[model samples]
Target chain A: MPAIEVEGLTVRYGDLVAVDRLDLRAEAGRILALLGPNGAGKTSTVETLEGYRRRAGGKVAVLGLDPARDHAALTRRVGVMLQRGGVYPGMGPAEALSLWAAFYPRPLDPAGLLERVGLSAVTRTPWRRLSGGEQQRLSLALALVGRPEVVFLDEPTAGVDVKGRQVIRSVIAELRDEGVCVVLTTHQLEEVERLADRVVIVDRGRVVADGTPAELVTRGAGRSIRFGAPAGIDVAGLAARLGAPVNEVDPGEYEVGAAASPATVAALTAWLAERDLPLADLRAGRERLEDVFLRLTATGGAGDGGQR
Target chain B: MSSSPAASARQPGATPPSAARQLTRALAAQTAAEARLTLRRGESVLLTLAIPVGLLVFFSVVHVLPLPAGVRRPVQFLAPGILALAVMSTAMVSLGIATGFERQYLVLKRLGSTPLGRPTLLAAKTLAVLAVEVLQVAVLSGVALALGWRPGGDPAAALGAVLLATAAFSGIGLTMAGTLRAEVTLAAANGLYLILLLVGGMVFPLSHLPGALADVARALPSAALSGALHASLTGGGPGGGVESWAVLAGWAVLAPVVAAFTFRWE
Candidate 1:
């Protein structure tokens, strides 16, 4: 069995169906990124798995235990890091960690975990008095103090500073290395690409895409050559010379798709030089996870999938 | 989904201290945290300890109450009433307001997600409330003794009466805090405190009011507590009667049961 599983999961809020027939599975020793646009039932589904919400229909399990039924048993082995407002405003980081450290069967040392999350400097600062990044770090530290087998992080790096993000990423990487199942929801595609072993994209409460990050990038959210050049260039002329499709993605920025071949790059450079148009910038055969995410969840691109 | 591996094979990691401490430690540590927080808040301290002390000192000195003809000293009457008020301040007002804000700030929700769970959390909170009440009783009793109020009733009975009142008030407070918004709870709790302070027969004689109003006030939880405390501590006052214990016991049982069913952890 996978570390976490959900099949035909349906969640509703009175008359509104929030999560509809959602399905997901995650395994140990890997990181799965759950991504979606706002109001797409991501929070609902995650909260149900965290046992904070009642599922309207379907099966959901973590560590082979039903989250809603065996919640007390499940919470002991699962670490859930909420996005905000978990600590007392008057309590400092060390104090809060120590307080929660008593909740599990075996917990990491509060002082050591604080330092691991780079919170040693602010161990004595009140939670409310800490900066946004410090608060995020403290939240992450609290989640790991339980020494859980599986961890759920909700936007762990949403507002974190660069240094804080680095600390969080490293700590998460360490968790994965220790064979912990790490499931997280984030809007940061770059973070997903850098850290996630698998990406699950949901749109309108349904899983639109699920695969390894590389598989996702190549799953018809295909390879492209994107560069900056003068506005209103002869995109059609370039497409014909390169035997590909070209478009000005934005003013003065262009994209050449259809494999972004080396021969295409050569022809494109040659064509640009023939017109004395400077090749301002060029990147070849690189596909971004953001493109896949956007294409899968675009507001107007619904049902179109936008695959090549 | 991978059927290839064990359901969840525990892997190697840092060895941390054993957790889910025995229930005794959970209760002790959580009670300490709760008591520390309740005492640490300047406003809660003022409301719980200082306000009752100030009221006892103020009313004993002011001579504003219409003391019935046979009463010997003002402190004799005011001490028990103020002590009852102290219970209300701590259990109903201070605790209720704090929990309201905790729920609002998602503190309760976060704690519920842990293994401490809801029942243990409530138990810890109750134990903390008992600890604070111990201080309230000792301080109020010392001040009363200094003011020449000679006690003639059972100290054990007085303590029992206070415990009964504590349970009733805590239940009512939790019900309010759990169901209402934090801001709404704040407004309503303070408003209830002020009303109970007057109608509880604390500083004045209930009999001095119109017959029907006095009878209604006598049935209020504040009145029941004051009457029970008076019967146990200072012998008997206008509000004191055997029926007071029955009324307080009724609420002691009913309120917590209601709260147990209605309270929302989140």
Candidate 2:
């Protein structure tokens, strides 16, 4: 069975529906990235799945048990890095980890947990004394200390630097390798691209799109050919000669679309050769994931403005 | 892997006194952790211990209020009342105010999500308040003994009186903290502490007041606590003033039940 199954889930805060008819399933060893902008209910969805908040409608089964009904049991098997959770100011990182680990039936070694989160050196430092990155690492250590079967991380790399982000990414990968399901919510698209096995893009409290990264990228349409033209070459003539629509993006840059990327590149190169014009730069590729994301999310536009 | 038979049987309603003991131990651990956090906070320490001690010293030495006949030595009469006030200040005011803030911060919510249940969390917080009470009593008792105040009866009864008082006030405190906004709870708790210290007979004898305030004093939790303790310290029989005990019992039962019903975890 899947580790988490959320079917027709709806959560409302008063009149505002935070999560609307959401359907999702995650298996044992894959990372599912819940990507959304602020106020899109990503945090609310995760909180409901973790049994921290009650769902107003539909069903949520986590690890084969209802999260809201079987909270204590679910807590034993799942680890949560609560959004903006604060530890006691006076407690040292080691003491806090040890204390939290003691609450679980079977927990990872405190020392090893610290070391894995890169917090071993400052284990003795009090929580208030730790830097922002260190605190984030400590939070990660606490979430992993229970040796949980599934982990829910919300904005886990919010304040971390590049190195710290990589450390968290690697730890998440390691968790996946060990057959631990990870549900990560993040605004950083690059991190999602690198780490997520599947993507769930939420907008205005609904899942607008859900698939693999590459799959979502090509959902928009065909590829485009972008190149820098020679100064005096008839950029408009080249467009007419190649029988392809063209537009100058800048003084000497132009772009056009093609059904086949290789054919487009060859046609552009030969067209330049016939005209004895130097093609300063040329490339053809599918629509970028970011481009697809913007198009799908933006309110005012449709499909790259018809290749212009 | 399956759980041990004993562990499986220990589920909610089954066998094993050991399971109950383990639950109690878990509760105690949670309580200790909370107390440790409270003690580490400088402001909480000041509010819990320092403010009461300061108030006690200030009211005992100052002769601002009038005294009655046969109540010679205002210090002696004020001493028991101040002791009760200390309990109220820590167990009721400080505890209530802190819990309100904790609820606002979602600290209590995090704790509630643990293997520990809501009832266990309340029990643990009450137990932690008791631990702080013991320390408060030791300090106040030491200070009182040094100040030439002598107990007229068995010391054990006095200790029992203080413990009962702590329980009664803690219940009221937790209830208010759980139900009210942090800002409102803070103001109400501190305001009530001052009102009780003066009019509820914590620093002044209720007998010294005229009809109206005296009647109100008799019903206040601080009055029951201070009067009961005063009666015990002065060798008075517990039989005549079962009213105080009854008042305390009413609060101890009602406040916790109400708190449990109304408490908001987030």
Interface RMSD of every candidate?
7.0, 8.2
Q: Clashes per prediction?
A: 2, 0
Question: Under the 3 Å rule for N, CA and C atoms, how many clashes does model 1 have?
Answer: 2
Candidate 2 runs further than 4 Å off: A221-235, A248-254, A272-285, A300-308, B1-25, B55-68, B154-164, B179-184, B207-211, B237-240
lDDT of 2: 0.75
Where in model 1 is the C-alpha error above 4 Å?
Answer: A221-225, A239-245, A256-266, A283-286, A304-308, B1-21
Tens-digit per-residue lDDT, A187-274, candidate 1? 9999999999998888888888898888887666337788888999989988988888999999999988766666777788889889
Candidate 2: residue A40 lDDT (0-100)? 78
Output the lDDT of residue B110, model 2: 61
Docking class of 2: incorrect
Q: In candidate 2, list every pair of residues with a backbone clash.
A: none
Write down the RMSD of all candidates, one decimal each: 4.2, 5.8
**What lDDT does candidate 2 reach at residue B48?**
70
